[model samples]
Target: MNDAHLHMLVNHFPIVGTILGLIILIGGVYFRSISIKNTAYFLFIIAAVFTVFSMSTGEGAEEIVEDMPTIGHEIIHNHEELAEKFAIVLYLLGVVSVIGLITNIRNHPKATFFSYAIVAIAAVAVFLSTKVGTSGGEIRHTEIRSEAVNQNSNAASPKSENNEY
Candidate 1:
């Protein structure tokens, strides 16, 4: 598959996985369960890893789509900028998770509290990261197309799509 296709698939892993991890993490905190918290931590770590994959492939993806009728330099720049931020947050999450895992294995009582703190920040990070991904999608897949890509492929067509294709 092309970089765009692969990037799209990898991008969602971070969004969904991060969201799920947030839920599980919050639930674990509420229930005072170590196993559940650790599980969520692992998920967050995995999400971060995929975020890297997405970010690394992003430049190539942009190269493929930059000249498309619906795409523009601004959109690519915006996506690149946002991806940098997302990468930072995801990397932080991964590092935090590593600490979390270590803490859990060593039975550090305070680790749970630390996890809560990290996840709280991670929740915000995840939100921003998703926004970046959506914006990037919008670069080539405008709202009109996005609205119908799944239901009516015709609507997703670029208004000036003929020029590029």
Candidate 2:
């Protein structure tokens, strides 16, 4: 498969993973469960790793799709910018998660602090994920673009028989 195809395959996990990790981490905090919190941390780390893969493939994918019909440098550039921000958040989450996992393992008093910090970071990551995902989708899905949607809506509206032109 080409870079674009590979990118499509691997790009979603980081978004979904951050969301899932946040939920799991919140549950862990609510229940005061170390294991659950660790699980969330693991997920974040995996998500961060996947982010690397996605970023690596993105340039190649751009090379392929940037010139395609309905796809151009501007859309890909927007997606790239958002993706970069999202990647930084995910990477920070991963590092913090590692610290959290270690602290929990050693039963450090600061473990709780890390957990809360992770929750906050994960929340940011989740927010950024939505933007990144939508921008990425817009790279290929013109139907979802605001201008395209507006044009389609206007064009698709029904005309009344007695309506003046």
Candidate 3:
């Protein structure tokens, strides 16, 4: 599949999986259940995998959408920047979650501590992802799209060849 298609398919996983993981993590903590906590840890791992997929397809996505009429270039720019930030956060959380899972399987003493720590990291990820999602949504949403048009109209310069990659 094309990058844009892959982007559309996988982009939702990080946020949605994080939310689902958070719910399970919270439940595990509240109920003090090992099974539930382990499940949440696995979910975070799955989310990490999706994050990789999203990132891998990003350049393809950018190439496809950066040339669309209106704010396509601007939206692609913002989305690229935000995606970079989001990837860093997701990678960190994913690593922490992996460690937490490994320790849990080994019956390590610090497993619970790492789980909570990963949860905290995941919370920050959730916030950043919301911003990313909002910026991405603006790419095509009428209100933001109109704003983009007006802002660019003021400049009224000849459209330069988009060199974004």
lDDT of each: 0.82, 0.97, 0.84
Q: Look at candidate 1 and tell me the lDDT of residue 94.
A: 81
Q: Report the poorest 10 consecutive residues by lDDT, candidate 3.
A: 139-148
- The model with the greatest lDDT is 2
Q: Which candidate would rank higher by lDDT, 2 or 3? A: 2
For candidate 2, the lDDT comes to 0.97
> What TM-score do all the candidates reach, one by one?
0.82, 0.93, 0.83
lDDT of 2 by residue, 94-153 (tens): 999999999999999999999999999999999999999999999888989989988888
For residues 1-165, what per-residue lDDT tens digits would candidate 3 score against the true structure? 788899989989987888888889989888978888889888888888898999899789888877877556767788889988988988888888889888888989998898789889888888888888888777767466546779778678766688677
Q: Using alpha carbons, what is the TM-score of model 2?
A: 0.93
TM-score of predicted structure 1: 0.82
The reply for model 2, stretches above 4 Å from the true place, is 156-165
Write one digit per residue (lDDT tens) for candidate 1, span 1-165: 999888988988887888888899888888988899889889988988998899878888988988988677887897789878877887898888889878988899879767887777688877876778687767866863355566566655546745763
Q: Global lDDT for candidate 1?
A: 0.82
How many clashes does each candidate structure show, in the order listed? 1, 0, 0
Which predicted model would earn the best TM-score? 2
* Candidate 3 deviation (Cα RMSD): 9.4
